[model samples]
Target chain A: MEPAVKKGPADILYDEVWELARTIVDARKQIGALRPSKLKTKNVSAALLEMDEIVKATEEASNTIMDSAEIMSSADASDAGYSALVQENCSKIFEACVFQDLTGQRISKVMTTLELVDTHLQDLQDLLGPEFDEPDDGVDEREGDEALLNGPALTDEAISQDDIDALFD
Target chain B: MTANKKDMSILIVDDYKTMLRIIRNLLNEVGFKNIDEAIDGVTALDSLRSKKYDLIISDWNMEPMTGLELLKTVRADATLTKLPFIMVTAESKTENVVAAKQAGVNNYIVKPFNAATLRSKLTSVIGEF
Candidate 1:
């Protein structure tokens, strides 16, 4: 009888792929809870669009997982076969997870921003009666009722000016 | 400006703080003393736009921006396009490599990988070892 092949890069790649599949499944469930609150805004249309892109990316990543499993189970499991390619391929998929995580965070922050914007708009509607003439400078800092919304303002935070200038030049 | 131990930074973009910590520790173990973290792609893009990184190690399954989008964006940028990028993902499909290669990935690594695999990926991708 042939000796059992030792666990090599293919096995490593397979286990990694399986673990990632599990992570994706878990993330999908977690994201379902977040989708509703994120979609609840007009200003968040951009963020919502971003969310769509992320979801698609996640799906695409999930799809690739099947290939990982296939390659492992096939003749490719041997080091003499497609193990090198599998290792390389696995890294790329792993890379996608990095971006997915980023997208999720961006969505969360944007959702928070959207909520704040909604609260501010409501206060402005109540204060100026919703028909105030547009201020020439359009910079109104009206303090409203007891509904104190606390968080970082999006405008106040951004990449620095030096960085911008460097990128442009 | 001179590059110090603190200046040779690596940016890790992933939504999971736990994963971020894992990667950071691995990079530290691999002699990369300086590191930055981004929770998602948009923020990562912002960071990439703002500073020059020695390396970018990212996850593939984030929301609002996946690693591929970030890679595409990074590749689209003329100045920052050449920066070395390594994708650390759980997805191991063949199409993933095709897309990532098309998007200009430097190297890819699968998750649950050890310190050796991480180091090897970085070395193979950037040849900075």
Candidate 2:
């Protein structure tokens, strides 16, 4: 505006550097919106947990149904026709019980996806520094019912029936 | 000689109603009709005190008192010390088995078991059905 002064290469470079810096700050602010604290209360984890509970509930129900069906199939051997019908229906129930197995596998896949999400969120939190870390709520992760009911260990720490029998021996 | 298979008094303990029903049904099918049930170790203990049972088949996981705890309590009691107690559980951890053995459990059976397996364990503990 004064006398049409021509900007030098250094001044032009400084303006360009500041513009790039402003853009980076804007990007950082956008990323900061994705707080790691949300992972605790987010539906993603809660939904996955619900899916796990569904698998367990379905397994229990399926077991009950299958057990009942087995009992019925074995009942009234004298009534050949009725017994045959029961045997056939029981077969169907047993076949239908596979749904629980399939559903369990499917939920397992979803749980894997949830794990991936958790891993990525963890990575993001790491990148964001300890300032984004959540405070400890002082909750102990209990297994089940006061007792250490860790229901069928998946690790190599689990033993076999033979091993258990050996203990009595 | 062993007592009649059907005459043997047995008690099955578990917190799950479905599991109790399944075990009861299986025991009935196997001709052990003289069977009682309790929902947890505490209930089983009360039942044990009030009635006489030749065998105790219990789940290891339960509220207030676990089967392991019950086994320890039974071993501590003078009359129940000699009682045949079998701990039935899905937990097949070696440490858990060691604990049960240390607690003086007569036998252990893993879950997802069949009537035949249950019968075999029962027979092993209470002298052949």
Candidate 2: CAPRI quality band: medium
Q: What is the interface RMSD of each candidate, in Å?
A: 18.1, 2.6
Give candidate 2's error at residue A77 in angstroms: 2.1
True lDDT of residue A99, candidate 1? 64
Taking the tens digit of each residue's C-alpha lDDT, what string does model 2 give over B19-87?
887888878778877889999989999999999888888999887888888988999999889988888
User: What would the DockQ be for model 2?
Assistant: 0.50
Give fnat (model 1): 0.00
User: After aligning candidate 1 to the native by TM-score, how far in Å is the CA of A79 from where it should be?
Assistant: 46
In candidate 2, the residue pairs with backbone N, CA or C atoms under 3 Å apart (3 or more residues apart, or in different chains) clash, namely: none
Score each candidate by Cα lDDT: 0.68, 0.79
Task: Assess the local accuracy of residue A60 in candidate 2 as a C-alpha lDDT between 0 and 100.
Answer: 68
Give candidate 2 misplaced runs (Cα > 4 Å).
A1-32, A35-49, A52-60, A67-74, A109-113, A128-149
On TM-score, the leading prediction is 2
Docking class of 1: incorrect
